[model samples]
Structure formats: structure tokens, C-alpha cells
Target: MIASVGLVRYAKCVLFGASTPRPEPDSGKVDFSAAAAAEVSVPADFRCPISLELMKDPVVVASGQTYDRESISHWIASGHATCPKTGQALAHQNLVPNKALKNLISLWCREENIPFDVTESEPNAVTANKAATEAARMTASFLVETLAASKETDAANRIVHELRQLATSGSDVRSFIGGAGGIPLLVPLLSSSEPNLQLNAVTALLNLSVLEANKKRIMHADGAIDGIVCVLSSGATWRARENAAAAVVSLSGVHSYRRRLGRDRRIVAELVNLVNVGPISTRKYSLDALASLAGDRENIRRLVESGVIKVALEAVEDADSADEAVAVLAALAKRGGAPELGVQEGVVRKLVRVLKNGSDSGRANAASALVYLCRKAGGGNLVAELAVVPGVEWVIWEMMASGTERGRRKAAALGRICRRWAVAAEADRLAARYSDVSLTVASSTRMAVAQ
Candidate 1:
């Protein structure tokens, strides 16, 4: 054990080009100070060549290359006979535990204040379901600690990337990350100038928010929503912005969270911007978040006020976003924003076009929005205008014929409004024409009588 500690100090000296006096074996503890541990980088040999992460359990295969036990086991299980690093064919598929290296890594982790349980790292330990869960929990705790202590941008980026991966693994692991206090640490990195760090941090939050408990934890964390909004508005990469929007969608799943997000005009504006200008996937995510926000009545007003109607109108023309855009419009209309939505230039026309030629969902939502507009006070004029659109009547007929039950109901209602408004408009036109003929005849009779 003294020799192993000596080896660790020598390896650190070689890697970091600094030296410290060897610890006395009688002390039974490594003499490295916390300051020294903070400065000591992980030795190259201590990291698994495959994962490039500190090895929890080091193992050697036939080619004499050391890798993390879990990593090498996965490699062999994938039917690869050759060593990953050397590409040399394995004479046998056996992995020998490098107990000395494992001990060195353990001592190094202890000195660095990183949690690494040797028992958890054993291959047989992971075979049991409970052991695997515990191992994930410990791993999450270690990652959270590393992320919190890391000052180097590159190191922080790598740790966050790993946290993102772990958060995505399963709901249990996501719960573990939240329990490990990873949410607060990740919230600050959402605004990181390092592009990868910001991207990974926001994405990890998105993954963590999949669990209901983590969603509350994330929202309650200070500056969490602000950090996410900053990323959504001006992130370093489009993917970062996209993931930030996705995080909003995840958080907006809760009613209270949705209302809180909806209160932020910046959040609504950014979502509208993304719906207007982002790529297909980004637009989809932004629209999804907007849809959730629109569930609140006040949010619907904010969305409409943020020029979302124009964005949705433009998006309705896109086959990729037609359904989502129309869904948002439907939500807005259903939530008392019908007057605002109905007044937008070309909105009715665009919705009619969607009803005629868009996807099933788009058509249904368009139908719903139109029905809402026609039900508002003084909506007969709007209905009259809709009835004149060339294909709207046929579209309504088709919806009633082949649409879902809800679609059929909306279509039937719209059809009745159109027919009623059309009849009323004709009656008004006839009344004006009749009055005109009477005036003309009266003028003729007066002129004849005066002559």
C-alpha cells in the first residue's frame, strides 16, 4: 500500500511536473492536502483509455491495455474480439483485475475528495439490480462534486457532458442526479460561454426534468429559469438554444410552472422567435413549449401579444410545423384570445388553407380555431368572410365526413355558422337592393309628375 501511494505521488509528479515528499507508511493515510488534490490532475494512466474518465475499477485484457471494467466488458459483449486501443485479436476473452491500479485510483479519489466505491465498481456487483442502482447514485454524486469543484472550462464541459448522458440513462438515474444536488450546479452553467458546457448543462437539465420531482427542484433553483431563458434567447449554438427550449417544454408540463413561465414575456418572445426562424426540430420544440404555456389564459394573451399569431400563420404554411402551429392557435383561441387571433392579417385565410390542405392534426386545430372565432360576439361578419373562401365549405364537408369525433363536431358547428351568416348576408343585400329600386321608381314618378 505504501508503494502504491508512492506510485500515485510519482505519477502525479510526472503528470503535473511537481513533486511532494513521500508519506510515511505508518500514517496509514495519503499525505496529499486538499489544495494539492485540487491542483493534481488525474494521471493519464488512471483514466480508462476508452472512456477517458477516471477508472473506478481498472482491468487488463489480453493485449495489456487497461480500460475501465464496465467499458471493456461492454466492448467484449458487443462481440469485438480485438482490443479497442491496439486492434489486436484477443487470444482469450478474459479480463484480469488490475488490483494495484484499482488501489491507486481509490487512493487518488480519496485524496481528491471524489467518491469511488471499489465494491460498486466490481463487475459482479452490477449484476444485481439494486447494486446497479446504487452504483449509478454514487456515480452521480461524484459527477456533481466534480462539476461543482471544477474551475477549468474544459474539465467542466466534460463533466457536464457526462452528467447529461447519465441523466438520460433512466428515470432512476435522473432522480439520483436531482438528489445529488446536480440541478443547482447545472443551472449556472446554462449561461456558460463555453458552447459545449452550456449545451450539455441545458440538455442535462432537460433530461433531469423528466422526473416529476426533479422538475420542481429545477424550477425552484435560483436563476434556473433565467439561465434557461438566456440560453433560449442567445445561446452559443443553435443546438443549445434548441435544448433550452426543450427544457422549458419539460418544465412547463406542470400547471404552476407553465403559469410562471408564461408570466415571463422574454420566454414567450423567444419561443415565438424560434417558431419563426429556427430549424425544423428547434421550431418543433419551441412550439411544443408554447403550446404548454398557452394552456394558461394569461399566457395565451402573452403569446398573441408577442406576435405569435404571425409566427403561427407562417408556420402553418410549413408541413413540418403545421400541426404544432395550429395546435398553439387552437389553444389561444380556446383560452379567450380568439378576438386577437381572428384579427391578424391573413390569419383566417391561412387557417382556411390549413383546413383545406394541412395534416390531420393541423386541419382539426384549424377547425377548432375557426369555430371559436365564429362563436365570439359579432362573429357573423367573420363567418361571412370565411364562407366566401373558395374551398372552405368543401373542407368543412370533408372534415365532417372523415375527421375525428371532435373534428366532426367542430366542422359541423362551423358549417352551421357559415350557413347562418351566409343567409343573413343575402337578406341584407336583398333589403338594400329592394330599397334602391323603390327610390329609383319614386324618382321617376316625381320627375314624370313634375313635367
Candidate 2:
């Protein structure tokens, strides 16, 4: 029995290693398998159509399609004009956050034992360092308090300028400023007579308006639109007016705000006036605001009545402003302004030049505007005119052969109209020639009879 026991002990020692416990897996480290992750069934709605992956930040485009913010932004930046999934042309490129969807996605991730940091997914949230973000928040709070207590004009300007810088730093800092009640304080200074104070205050509001929440806050604040319009209409300096226009653009991102702004005819008139006479930069900013507001029918009417067509026609002739000008024209055409555009002299010719040699976006807009104009003017006259323009038909043919999907559609429509007009004209000439030949033959027969 003792020999058997010794033999058993020796066999266990050789096979299993002597007196060593099997090391438990390190509790701190968990190994996750890629295959296992692949096997996880993510909901379809949780995935971005462009990336085909779970969305970290969901944003809804004007087409009402929800996509990952980065993915949709890249799509728009790459010159795509339509929604990826629905293929509808985007009315505007505003990417409103889908907070409810984001919350659902976060909840799903937690339930599935996946790691997702919601705060890290903010569109402009500064997440590189928690300590730095906290410091910025604290600093913003202090500045807001100081600005509230400040009675000296020089000191107020300096403080407002600092707050503007902070607001421009990141979305988090803007949120902090808004949270600290900085918007109300800034609104009162928008109409300040002091140039620097007015500039700084309007600029600070402009910077803070970048965040969606701050946009609402700024819009709803008492006399905010009035103040911004005041600055835009009669600010002491061009830079202040430019930023005031920019702020209007930012606020008009929301549809309701656009309606409210449309109610104020002065806003539209001021922007039109700027586009007519302001410097290059100010005109550009004014054009941007006008473009955003042009989405509403009332705003389009306001723009037309304010003489936008004349300035837009002039802008189309200038290379610096042609693209934005064409885009605005297209928007107006889509929204009941086509008749006015059709009445403008040389508008068709200018658009033809753009179609031949403008940037991709400009070409697309020009094509769209021309099509709308032709349709509104009764295709025959405009189509005949277009068919005769030097190289216009060739440009249309090329666009049909090779262009973006939307561009191709517009080009094909224009080409069809032109071709139909050409064919009809050729048929009429042939028929007239045949009639003249028959009449001459009859005259010869009559002469022979007389002889």
C-alpha cells in the first residue's frame, strides 16, 4: 500500500507540476473577442447609414434622416447634396442633435455590457482633459459674475472680449457661459453705443450661439433678435455688423427662429442692403444669413420685395460671390421667386456662364436655377434661347453624361427641353422650304400655260 501511494504521488508530481496552484486570470483585465463583438446584434436604427456602425453622435439632417454626426458632416463636406438613404435633396445642411436617440443608444450599450462615454460624443465637447474642462467652467462662471458687476465701459469691453474668446474655445465653455447666465447680460450690451463694447458683446453672443442650447437661449432672451437686428442694421463698425449677421445665421438654423425673423422685415431688408453695398466679408456673411432665412416662403417674398434679384444678378457676375449668389437664387426659385428671376435681364446668360465654368456647387445651383426659370417662363421661349447659347448645349450634354446624381437629373431635363425646341425649329424650317419649292413650281407651270 505504501509503494502504491508513493507511485501515485510521483505520477501526480510529474504530470501536474509539484505544489503550484493554477494561476487565476487577472481580475483587473478582461479579454474581449472581436468575433464575439461581431456576433452582437446592434439595432439597425443605432447604426449610421454611411458608416454601417453604431453611431457615437446621432444628428438629424434636414431630410429627417438620422446619421452619425461625423459621417453626415463628411458627406456634406464632400459636396453631396442629397440624403444618403432617401436620396432627397437637403433643404439645409443643419445637423440637429437627436438627443433622444442618443440616450436610447447609450442605454442599449450599457445593457449589452459595452462601453460608451456619452459626454465624449458631444459635437464640440472638449474631452481631452477633465481637469481643464472644469477649470474653463469655473473661469466662465467668474467672468459672468464680473461682467454683471462691471460698471466701467473699458472693463466691460475687456471682460466681454475674454468671454468671447472662452465661448469660441469649445462647446463646453459656451455651455458653461450659458449656464452662468451670460446671455442675458450680453444682450443688454448689443445696442451699446461704444463700438468696442458693442462689437465684443455681439461677437460673444455670436460665439456662444454655436451651441444648440445657447442658440435657443440667445433667441428667447428679451430683445435678442431686436438687438441683433439693431447691430446688423446700424452697428458702429463693419465687423460688428458682420458678426451680427453671422449670429442671425446661427439662430436661423431652427425653423421657428426663421419664422420669427421673417416676421421682422427689417432683418431681411438689412441683409439685402448689406449684400448690395457692404465689403466682401460683410456681404458674404449677409448672404449666408439670407440663404438660411430664404427657406421660408414669407422670407422669400420679403427678399424679393427688398430687391434681392438685382443684387443676386450682380453677384452672379462676380467670381468671389457667384457660388453663394447662385445657391440663393436656386433657393428662391424653388420657393415661388422664379417669376421674378425670369424677368431679370441677362440672368439666363449669366447662369449659362456659371454652368460652363463655375465650381461644382455653383454649376449645380446654376443648372437648377435655369431649369426653374425655364419652367416658369413657359419652356418654349427660354428653351429656344438656351439652345442658341454658345456651348450651353454641350455643357448640358457633359453634365448628363458625367455629373452628380442630382446634377445629372437637372442636366437631362434641360437637355430634353433644348433638344425638343431644336427639333421643332428644324421641322418648321424644312416644312417652310418645301412649301416655297411647291409654290415656285406652280408659278413655273402658270408661266408655261401663259406662253
Candidate 3:
């Protein structure tokens, strides 16, 4: 084992020659021929006992077991190679180049007349080298095509099974089909002439969109957004619309994609309108996408100017739909950073009122949003107003008082806010009362804090 480790170290040192930095991401073709052409004479000990060869196929000499050369080479390359007999790895330096290849090499040497001298000769063998290189290249090309076909076939199977699952299962079966390529394969199917396949494709893409990476690719794919919107405008089934809206919601999660949907008339005019007009379920996800994208500053101004904010605000007012108010408030807080916009006129006050009267989750979201808004607004006045609002102080006080498990969690968050506020307010009062002394104290305190 120690000898093997030493051999590996020596081999790496010789091969890598001082550990140079890796090249940047490949832009041009990778010259595997160049790499294969670089090999020198095979190491002596790495020769296979069975063939007494240079280990042409890299057969594994494992615990009374032998692997084909290709299998052994692949395992070694992946750092998975082990001796079949002892389960110990071969020394990294002990590369078993094809020695029986000597006959081939000698013929090539005579034909090509490249010397055996390392300083003067080309490294590749003469006879079998060209055949080996061609075989490897052809095999790699074939493997790539095979994998692509397999992915398309698997996607078709997923589409069929997914439809049956969608109809019979209680929840969306997206989590079951996981892969970076799933979205790409299913996108083309969304526009398939076959209705069942088209429906299943939409369902699959919707599920794929739940993942951030998949959604990025789906949106970037040619005509994907337009195809989905066309489906929406064509009066597809509610299930289809719901899934489409979910995909839009996923796309909207990326801020840069806001404008991608703008030019698609089916999206802006048809789907955006559905936030207020579609069936209850469809409207929910559609509004969610609209609300999230509305938080993008330019998109927010565009949406508001287009009169969509009013519709969203109205939804917040409906008694049966008050649950959505939290989402509306959160979105507005994100888009409308300052209380001056509309936070002062109504949003904050309404959220504050809800803090006293709404359900626990709603009240929690409202309270969190108010605190966030106040912090962003950055004023002593806003802080004072929040501190003294009817039930606001008591709510915080009760939160700090409860001492239950959840209450303890809330207490930690509130404590940090209160601590910062206390320090900032005290610094202001001291600066006014004892200007010079306050400067000295603040400096000393700052130094101490830094320490």
C-alpha cells in the first residue's frame, strides 16, 4: 500500500509537472486523439498475466476475476478501479499500455520511421493506434446518439404514465420525474398534434418548472412561452390552464424574465386578464405569477399603470378571499419599498388592522411585512407609530411573554430588532445631549464592539 501510494505520488508529479492550473471551459473540440497520441511506452509491471500484453483493453486483475480492457480503463479513469484479487487500486503511474501492441508499434515505427527516442519520436504506436483512435471516436458518437434517443423514449413513457397518474393520483406527480432534460424533452410535446400527448407534455413541463434550473431552460427554449400562452388563449381545459399558469409563475420567479412575457399578447392580454376572470383555481396561480412579477420595479409600474394593482387590491378586500391579502401586501412591500407610495395611505394601516383581527398566519405575514417596510423606510416616526399602534405593542409583548417553543423563536427575532433600535435611538439621544462626550463614548463603544 505504501509503495502504491509512493508510485501514485511520483506518477502524478511526473505527469502533471508541478500541478498547473486547469484550462478554462472548453470552446473548441477536445482532442482525445491528441491525448491518446501522447502515451509513451507501457509500464513494465502493469502488464496483464493472461495476455502477457500491455493491457490493451485494461483488463482488471481482481480477486481471481478479470475485466475486459475497456471496462478496466473506464473504472480506472473514474477512480473506481480495484484489483479483482485484492480490491486494491493499481498504482496511478503504472498505466498498462498495450504491450502485445509491440508488434503493431514496431511495424508503425518502421513505416513512419519515428525513432524510439522520447526526445525525437512521436508517442503514438504505429500499427494499431489508428484503428483504436477511430474505434473510440465512433463509439463516443454512437453513445451520444443512443443517450439522446433514450431520453426521448423515456420522456414519452413519462408522459403516458403521468397522465394516468394525474387523473388517478391525489397530487401532481412531478416530483416523480426528476431530471434536467425532462423539461426539454416535454416542451416539444406541448405542441404535438396528438391531444393526449400535448396535455401530458404540459403537465410534465409544469412539474419540471417547479425546479429552478428546469424552468430556466424551459423559458429559454424557442417559442416555449408563446406555445403555452397559445394554449391558454385557445381555451384549453382548466387543468391545462392551471398547469400553464404554474409554468408562467415559475418563469416569473426570475426577475429578468418579466419582459419575456410582455410581448406575448396571449400572456399579457389573455393570461394576465385571467388573474381576475379565470376559474377560481386558475385565477389563483395566475394572480400569484402576476403579483410576483409586479414586484419587479419596472414591471410593477407597468402593471399598476395598466390597472392590475387595483384588481389585486380589491381581491384583498373580499371577505372570502382575504387570505390573498397577505400575498398582495408582501408583493407591494417588495415593489413599493417606502411607506410613502401607498403603504401610508392604506396598505400598512390595513395590514396593521389585520394584525389585530386576521387569522394567525395572515397576522404573522402582515406583522412581518410592516416591520420590513418600517425598516426599509428608515425613520424614527415610523418606528414610533408601529410601537404604539393599538394591539401592536401588546402583540409583540405577548410574543415575548409567551415563552412557548414557537414564541421563543419569535422572541429571538424581535429581540434582535429591539436591540438594534435601542442602540440607534440611544446614539441619537446621546449625540444631542452630550455632543463631545457622546462622540467619545460612541467611538470607544465602536472599538469595543469591533474587538
Candidate 4:
């Protein structure tokens, strides 16, 4: 644990840049205390232009601009494509790590006794836990004071780094943070123009959102929804999109919050776009958010209007995401605006496929969706034959009507299902054939021949 702590501190410091907040030395204090000069003085060339800290892992940007590697990475990740100092278009953005500068900084810190207490380790769990709690309590207080005391982005950056570190510790740390006024402090940072702050703020919130108490508090926080929506609106950075989506997904699990989340069309649009084209993990989070929001019938209307059902059709065909896609479809399938679009996009075939070759839970969801579709078709509205799957409605209806009350379950076997073939056989417009041949469901002529 001690070794890991040192590595993290080293990594955090390596993000040094000149653009960061630097505390100006007080000339009055310098004159009064001669030792202050010795404490503050460092070789000028050793500092990063962006952070003004002695560089740990220095690197050169494409514009011949030298900066710490982590700092430059944060800059580029915030959607900067050009040099921060020169404003010149970079032919490419790359950081070539400077090993010589790193070694020099290590040697310098060693000589200055800077590594004297990088981490406090007592090797006793109880003692370590107390120390960590005290540190977290103090750090949380510092953040509250900093935000209230000054309007400095750099200072905020440093505070957010600690918030992120604490967040990564575990849910217990996150609970500690929520009690320390971390959620409210973290909410405003999501609107920050600083990419690094926005990244960590959202990450910290996400880590805490696993607690239902934090989720409710965060949802009601001022500027929270708008801040998250703004991040989703930014198509530029993966950090913003990924973490913001994750935060939304976490907060969205609370049943009461679904209506408010679904009411935001921009968020809904962004989620839809993400599903159709975002990174794989982003797609999963986005889909989960949409599915939860689909709890509201009006939100389901919006999702259908966004043509998500078609995207869902495509998503269902993929093995990795099939269950998640099915979950979303099931959520939306029972609503008015969703059914026609789903059927138009060949959802019947997809649902049947899910029913045939899905896990018990997946199959139940698919079967429920199929039943909902059946009810929609049979519900006083005349749906065109081509607009619906030919015999799936008949199949689902039969299973429900004749499914026995035996042992609290029925239709667990195809034999029970075959007995209900008589229902399909008796209908004049339908042609149902059953044999002892195979146990597959043939909802249409094509399916039967394929079987």
C-alpha cells in the first residue's frame, strides 16, 4: 500500500504545468523571514511552463513546447489540438517523454529530503484507517474553504485530484465524501472549462452515486442536471462523455428520478446518438440510462421518436449486448409510440430470436415484449398484416390462454406449447402444423420450412 501511494503521488505531481495555479511568494514574508527564500527557491528551468512545478516526467509537445506528460495529456484530452503557449496548429499531438528530466527531478528530490514522508504507513489496519479518515476529513474541509475563498482554477484542479483519489479508495470513502459536502462541491466543477477538473469531478460523483443517499442528493444539486447534459453535449472528449454518462446511469437507477431524466430531450438525443455511434462502453452506459428513463411512458414516446428502436434492433443482433438491448426494447415495447417502429424494423423476428435462444431472464423479457406487442395489435386498433409479424401474436396468445395452472408454471416444455397448436390450427386465416419431429417454434411459413 505504501509503495502504491508513492507511485500515485509521483504520478499526480508529474501532471505539473505552468497553466496551473501557482501561489505567488509574498515579498513581505520573504523579507521578514530569510528562511522562506531558501524554502521556495528552485532552479528556474526545472519548472513546467503550464504548472510551474518542478517536472517529474517532462515531455515535449509538437510545437516544441516542453511540459509534463500528464499535464499535456490532460490539455489534449480537453479537446485542445494546438499548442497551449503558441496557439499554433499542431501537425500532431504527441508527448515524447523526457527520461533525462525525470531522473534529474528524482535525484533533486532525494537530495532535498522531499521524499521524507511521501506516505504515512503504520502497517496496522486500525491505525491506518484512522489516519486515512482524518486526512479525508481535512481534505474535504480544504476543498470547501478553497471554493469559498478564491476563484482559482488551478487550486480547484489540485482539490479535485484529491477528491478523485479519495473516490477511488472505495465506497466507504465515497460515503465519507457525501457526508463531507463533497457532492455539492463536486457538482459545480462539472461546468468548469478545465477538462481535468470536469473529468475528476464527474468521476468522483460517479463513484459516490452507488449510494442511494448520494444519488438523491446529487440529482437535486443546483446545476447538476444541466452540467451533466452539457458534458454529454460535448462530442469532443471521451473523458467528459464516458464519466458523465456513467454518472447519469448511476443516478438514473432511482425509480423516482426517471421522469425528470426522460424529460430532457437533449440528454435523450445525446444518448440516442451515443447508442448509434459512441464507444462500446459508452454505448452500454447510454443504453442503461435510456432503459431506466423508459420507465416513464412519455419518455418512451421520446425514445421512439428518436428512432432508437431501429438502433435497438441492430444492437439485439450483437451477442455481447443482446441482453441489454433486449432490456431496453422490453421497456419501450409496451408503449404506444414504440410498437410500430419496432415492428417496422423487424422487431418481431428479433424478439422471437431472443425468446428462442436467450437465457431464462432474457427469454422472459423477450416473451413479455412479444405479449405486449400482441396486446398492442389486438387492442381495438387495426394494424396492417405487413406491419406485424404474421403468427407471433397467435403463438404468444395461445401460450397465455392455455398455459395450465399446474404447479404454478406451465409451457415449460414444447409439449405444452404443441397442445396449444390446436388454437392456431382452428383459426381460418392461420395454418398451424405440429408434429413429434422437432421442438422449435415456427411462427410463420418461412420459420416452419426453416425448422
Candidate 5:
């Protein structure tokens, strides 16, 4: 069986022109010809062992074998700690990005017209299939070359712009970029002490992660999430904050990573601060990240203690973010033990306000938050408070009469619980349920978020 398997493997390799040259044990000289193919031909050394494709990004393991960055990242995230090629136990999980090899492969790619771009302008407006097809055309080779440098600030800025464009371009582009070793190469930039470089790298990763495969690779890459959280917990420009938060949102969405992510108080605090005062983009991502983090019940208290509830209440006033904010608030409430925190934070009134005048989606989510807050053990009494809000009954009735199917169900359910159950009242109900509570905690959190 073993001999037959070897024969089949050899046949496959012969057919594909894909095989790694093995070095003899105890021999100091490893054959260099196969891996050292000239720019005119693809180098076998550039191909990842797992994917059997030329590696755009290569990383070495403890066993001294190299594989594509995405392949290895996914393997690590799935709980393996062994070299794919040698099956040797990994000494550690840290991945050292292979910049030199990437540089060589990138140079070769440029020469082959495989295309890479670091653009100042957004080329993102194109569709994924279109961009993928067009990838054979000249890529912004200048940007590609710029990325290979360690200290080219101007080039790095353009790298961010072009990466963002490609991220938005579509799946094919992201798949191509990921397969080309883009994620592995770019992830190191997130850890740079230079704030600009970190910002550019994170923003690019945030965009690149829209591609499904890139998400796994970005999450497990050494220092990627930690660096992003550092920027979030510390201070950066609003754009940087927005980009960082956006990246966190993407990473936190993966369930396996959320447990570790939720334990970070800095992450929750900064996201709460961003929810309170960051720009719309930042707020949106923070809200989503919070929602995902809340999935871990252990993180709920820290989130509430960090002022997440109050900031989320205030966020309802933003037309663009109200839906997401309310959804996050609902998730927090449902997480157990944190239901009362929302009531104390004035979530009831903010939700009522959303139900009264927020867009359809916002109304539904707000209604959901209100229902959870009023029905939970710690918050059941708050149902009466919400019942008396001037327009509460009217909003519920309005939803049942004209809102979306899901929204109407939430409104109807809330009406029944509060005994303000009538779908008939038209009085104004959206009002502040309580003044901001424990501003001391929130104040301290804001300091961490910005200072």
C-alpha cells in the first residue's frame, strides 16, 4: 500500500510539474536548482507545500519547512501545532514573515506581469470577477515594489489605499491576493511601532479580510490582533481608529477566536469609547465587535462596566448606526447578568426613541433590545417604565400596522409584556430613561480610548 501510494504521488507530481527537491540526511549541500528557478520560470521554493501553488507569501516552521501564509494560518487556527511537511511538533506558534523571499517572488511576479498594485486612488469600484480577470494586466507594480521596503512611508500610504481598493474589488481579487502571499506580507506591518505603518497595514488587512480565506490568516498571524487592539486602546486618528475597529469586527466574527478576544478589557473599553464618540465607520465596527464579543458571557460584565451600555444608548441617535447599536445592546442584554446594566444605562429610553422614529431596521433592533431588557430577571420591572413612555404604545401599534414582519412581532411582544399592550396609544414615549450612570467609569474609559 505504501509503495503504491508513493507511485501515485510521484505520478501526480510528474503530471503537474510540481515537486519539492529533498535534501539528503547528513548531507550539508541541499540541491539548489529546483528552488532557484530564474525569473523566467516559477520557483518551486516559492510554492507552499500544502497548497501546491507558488507561494505569494511564505512562512517557515520550526521543522525548517516553509508553506504559504494562509495555509499555515488556517492550520494553526484549527488547533494544529506541527509542521505540515515534517509533522514535527512546533516549538511555538509564532510565524516569522518571510519578507526576503516575498520580495524575490514579488519581483518575479512583476516581471511576469502577474500584477500587483499599491494605488493612491481607489481601483475598488470594479467588480471581483472583473478585477480578477484584469489582474493579468499591469498591476500598480510601483506599489508592489514599495511594499517590499521596510521604511518607505510614502509608498506605505499608497499601499493602504490600493489594498483598500482591492479589498472592496471582490472575492476573486481577495482570493488572488491571499494566494499570492499578500496577507502574510502585510500582517507584519500591523505590528510596526510606527503608528502610520500600523494604521496602513491594519486598514489594508481590514479590507483584505473581506475575502473569506484572508480572515482566518489575518486572525492567527503573529501579533496582528494584539497590535490592532493596541491602537484601539491607545489613541490614533479617527480614520485609523475606524480602520482598526473595522478589522477587529472582522476577526471577532470568527467564533473560535471570540473567547480569547472577549477576555481583553482593553478591547471592550476602546470599542465602547468608539461606540460613544468615534466616527460613524468606527462606531459601526465597534458595535459589531461588541455584539460578537458579548457572545462570550464572561465579557458582558467588563463591557457593561466599561460604559458600553451608555454609549450604545446614545448611539441610537445616529441614523446610520442606530440599527447596529441597538442590535449590540440586545445581544448584551441577552448575554445574561448584564440585562440590568442596560436599564441603568438608559437603554430603555434610547430604544423607545429608535422605535419612535428610527428607520425600519433600527426600530426592529431597538424593539428587540427593549423586549429583552424588560423580560430578563434583573430587568423585568423596567417593563413598567417602558410601558409609560409617551409614544411606546403607538410605536408598537405602528410597527404591527406598517413595519416589517420581524419588527412588528417584536413590537407586539413588547406591548404584551409591558401591559401597555394596546396597539392604540399614540402618545410620545421616546424619552431619556435615566441620566448617564457612573460617569466615572465611562470617563476613565474615554481616557483610555483616546489618550
Candidate 6:
């Protein structure tokens, strides 16, 4: 049976141009050319061993020394190379060469004096030497076609289609718009009553506006900024607000819009008002935009003075718990402007109150803000006194026993506060004995439940 099987294999190889003489069973010599030719003959072997394609998105085979489109392609097709021998999936870190393919390539390269270049961007050494100019030309042509397709009147139902086309077109969309004549194509869609149409148009514009040319178009279109602001200002659907926020975020990135957001002041006031009165979704988006702008120190100071901080504080006071307020507070704390605005001006006190009594999220953000404020407030006795308010300690202990990640993060933050507030020994002991505390807390809570 073994002899018959070997004869059948030899017959198939012969049909496929395998020209080497079959070795006797005792022959130790390996036949390189015949094996290489046989491996190459099966186009399936030529398919990407990873993706199983004809070397599309090719990766180096695990043996780490060869370059055969066929072998790599085969590995992809067979799915044997997905997980390593130990069963760990082929993550980005475990990449190695396909030994057979590498040996073949090295043999071919040695014979032909060709160097293999296999960087990710140059995965196919055979194709790597192709002219960049030629590739760019093809890419530009693709973008032009896709840009045309995306402009179809019914872009609403075709968003996925448009997105795929846009992505494939590469970066030319921005470069082309930066040159000239693209704004006219993108502006009208902003006013479309159809939410999806407006969303796609705004998104496309946001993408294209990254370049100088499209930004000029935005300013040239007298109503583009107003239209975006209107969408943001209105109680449009969440998707619309998200799109509007994205576009606004993009426009705000342009120097042309900087004055509009800052010196001109109208846009800032409107955005702040949205933070106070817009729907919860709209408010979130508005605050996100504000947070982005506040990266500029002047903008941060302006927000502190805008009365929005008080409004946010009041909202936290009014919430059933503090989750809704935490995101905003975390952003403010991250900006580190509390001292300049005066923590003693009531924000700090209220935040400490929230840290002691607010919901898990609120306490976390408030705790974070307190840490920043204490450092900024010069880490004096006043801060320590505030840190250990009876109420705050009670809340911290309660949160340390909670199950949520936010609860845990809050508890950790509180522990840091305890250490900083001259309770370092206690905090250290607690850290060293966390397991005991956890068990005690669990048992006591359960017994309390039984009682």
C-alpha cells in the first residue's frame, strides 16, 4: 500500500512538471529544484497561507527565511498557520518566516542575485520595486471614481458603499479638496432634511476638510458653519448631533474657525448653552466639543468663567447618581484648571461633597479632581482636612466594597488620598492586606443580609 501511494504521488508530480528522479528509500539526498517546482505548481500553495488569497495581503511565513508567494499563500489557505504550534493564535507578535518558502526564495535569490524586501509595506518583494508615482496615479484615479460614486443623490441608503469607496480612494480626497473646486460638491448636503444624508455629507466634509483647500471651501460656503452649528444647536437625533459634533470638531480644527470658537465668542456661548439645556445626548456631544477646545489654555479659562462649571455642578447635584456628571468632571480635572478658577470658589467644596455622597462614577471623577486640586492647591492641611470628611471616608469605604470597575478605581483613588493625607501607614497596611479586607467585607455584607 505504501509503495502504491508513493507511486501515485510521483505520478501526480510528473503531470505537474516535477522532473526530478525519485530517490530510493535509502537515498538521503534532498531534491531542491523538483520540490520547489512542485510546491509552486499548486497555485493553492501560491495563495496567501494566511488569507488564502493569491498572495493578497501576504505575510511572511513562520520559518522566517523564505519568500514564496505560493507557500505563504498556501499557509493562509490551509489555516494551519493561524494558531502557532502551541495553539496561540497568530497575533501581531508571533510572525515568523515560512521555512520552505524562505529556502526557495533564498535559493532563487542566490541564483538570480535578487534581494528580498519583505517589510509590511513591501510585503511582496516582486511588487515592492514598482514606482511610487505609478501607484499614486492609480490611487488618485480610484479616489476620483469613488468620490463620484459617493455623490450619488441617494447617498443615504448607500453610506456603507460610499464609506468603502472613500476608504479605497485613499488620502487623495483631502489633497484634491485642498487644491480647488471641492466645496461646492460638499456644502449643499449639510442642509438636507434627511438625517442620514446630512450625517454622511457632514462626515465626508469633516474628512475632506482636514486639508487647507476644503477648509477654504467651508468658509467660502457662507452657511456651512451656520448649518453645522444649527444641526448642533437643534435637538436633532443623536446620530445627527454626533455628526454635527464631528463636523464642528473638524471645523474647529481649522484656524479659520478658531476665531469663531474663541475671539468671536458666538460659537462658544452657543456650545456652552447646549451643555446646559440640550438633550442629554446633545449635551454630551456639546461637552465633548468644549473639552476638545479647552485643550487651549485660554479656552479652558474661558469655560471656567462661562458659568457652565456651576451649571455642571448643579446638574451633578440634581442627578439620581453622578455617572452623567463624571465624564464632564473628569475632563475638567484632566485640564487641571481648577486652581486658576479657584477651588475655594465653591467647585472644590461641592466636588468633595459629591465624592463623599455621589454615585460611583461621580465619586471617581470627584476623587480624581480632588487629587489634582490638592496638588494644585499646594497640598496643605486644608486639602487633607477636606479629604477625610466623615462623609467622604464613609463613602470611600462603601465604594471599596462595591463590585464595579468604576467603584474599584474610585476606591483606589481614595486610598491614594488617604496616603497623601498623612494616613500612609494605614493605607500601606490596607494594601498589604487587601485579600483579608475583601473577605471580611464580603462576609460582613452577607451576614448583614442574613440579619
Q: What tens digits encode model 4's per-residue C-alpha lDDT throughout 1-451?
A: 6334534443444354112433322211100011122354444345553333355567766654567564466557747576543233466876776666666766776776554222321232312466555554554555555555546777777676556654544344556677777788888888777776776677667766755667778988898898888777772366567567766665665556767887888888888887787766566567667766775677777788887787777878976567667767767865564446444646667877776566443554566465456456452221232124456445444545543222012223322333344344365234333432233443465686888
Better of 4 and 6 by lDDT: 4
Report the lDDT tens digits of candidate 1 across residue range 348-396: 8888888988765567778888999878625866787798898788889
- lDDT scores for all predictions? 0.73, 0.74, 0.48, 0.58, 0.61, 0.49
Candidate 2 residue-wise lDDT, 284-387, digit = tens:
66776776777677777888888888888888888878876887888788788998888777888999998998865578778888888888866577777778
TM-score of 6: 0.44
Identify the candidate with maximal lDDT: 2
Predicted structure with the largest TM-score when compared to the true one? 2
Lowest lDDT 10-mer window, candidate 5?
A: 24-33
How do the candidates rank by TM-score, highest first?
Answer: 2, 1, 5, 4, 6, 3
lDDT of 5 at 349: 72
Q: Candidate 5: which stretches are off by over 4 Å?
A: 1-146, 149-151, 156-161, 191-196, 296-298, 317-321, 342-346, 378-380, 420-451
lDDT of 3 by residue, 380-412 (tens): 556655555666666666655643332334434
Model 5 Cα lDDT, one tens digit per residue, 1-451:
4334334433443344222222112211111112233223345456554433456557766544566666577667767666543233577877776777778877877777665332221322333234334541123232344456536655565565455444443445566566665676676666566565566566667766654577777876777767777777663456567667666655654556666777788788788877876766567767867876776677777777887777776777777788767767766776773455544645577778888888665786677777777667454457756777887787788888987555777788887886643332323232222224456668889999998
Off by over 4 Å in 2: 1-88, 91-125, 427-451
Listed in order, each prediction's TM-score against the native is: 0.67, 0.71, 0.44, 0.57, 0.59, 0.44
Error of 1 at 52 (Å): 28
User: Which residue segments of model 3 deviate by more than 4 Å?
Assistant: 1-199, 232-234, 253-272, 294-298, 319-321, 337-349, 357-361, 371-392, 396-451
Between the candidate structures 1 and 2, which one is better when assessed by TM-score? 2
Decoy 3 TM-score against native: 0.44
